[model samples]
Target: MSLDYLQLAGTKAKGKRPQFFADSDNERLLSILMAVAGELAVTRERLDTLERLLEAKGLLSQDEIETFTPDSDQAEARGLLQQEYIARILRVVQQEKEALEEQQHCQSNNDLSEIEQELSRI
Candidate 1:
């Protein structure tokens, strides 16, 4: 079975993100760190599986695996994967930033209304 890494990476989770820490920034950082840890764990498992399969078939060796290099197209695809991975990890931060911007925008509009009200009384 083939996995669509890019499509899966781009998918956003629905519903509000729960916070375990008092500070939202701490929560965001925790999310990012956990994502990194989870990615590392999955990658390690996949590498182990590949190594075992190759050894079983006598198709690859440790030295060859270490020295293997990708062609240009493969390199570009790997780069895209890396970008998607990073984006997934940073999603929390991006959400927080958007929320804060929206809050500030609303506050500015409210402030403008207050100023206009005061000006009308003059």
Candidate 2:
């Protein structure tokens, strides 16, 4: 069977996520920033490759690439791609937020149990 990269990327590992910093939010932010950086690096490399290939094939020049502007449809398509790219980068923050909310819910339940027990003693 062919590998499904999108599925693999979305899958969560079985074990607890490792924390590298004291604050979990900091770690999540760092993950998001790193994802952005990685995406930018890959995009830059791919763009450069495409530019080189086009120039070599006598189809386009570096000056033309620099000055080219997308029309309405192309711009709309790129806007959609940008939205998806941003969502991918922010996935870490979203996951962490959900995990934090779950933790707070569990803590609230435990606190409620303790309060009930204390009320019973009074």
Candidate 2 residue-wise lDDT, 1-122, digit = tens = 11243334445558887789998779988888888999999999999899999999999998998899999999987776766677678777667677899999999999999999999999
Best by TM-score: 1
Task: Name the lDDT value of residue 12 in candidate 1.
Answer: 64
Q: Give TM per candidate.
A: 0.74, 0.70
Q: What number of clashing residue pairs does each candidate have, in the order they appear?
A: 0, 0
lDDT, candidate 1, 1-122, per-residue tens = 11465456546689877789998678878999999999899999999999999988999998899999999999987888788888778877766677789999999999999999999999
Task: Write out the backbone clash pairs for model 2.
Answer: none
lDDT of each: 0.84, 0.81
Residue 2, model 2: Cα distance from true site in angstroms: 21
lDDT of 1: 0.84
TM-score of 1: 0.74
Best by lDDT: 1
Which segments of candidate 2 are over 4 A away from where they belong? 1-14, 100-122
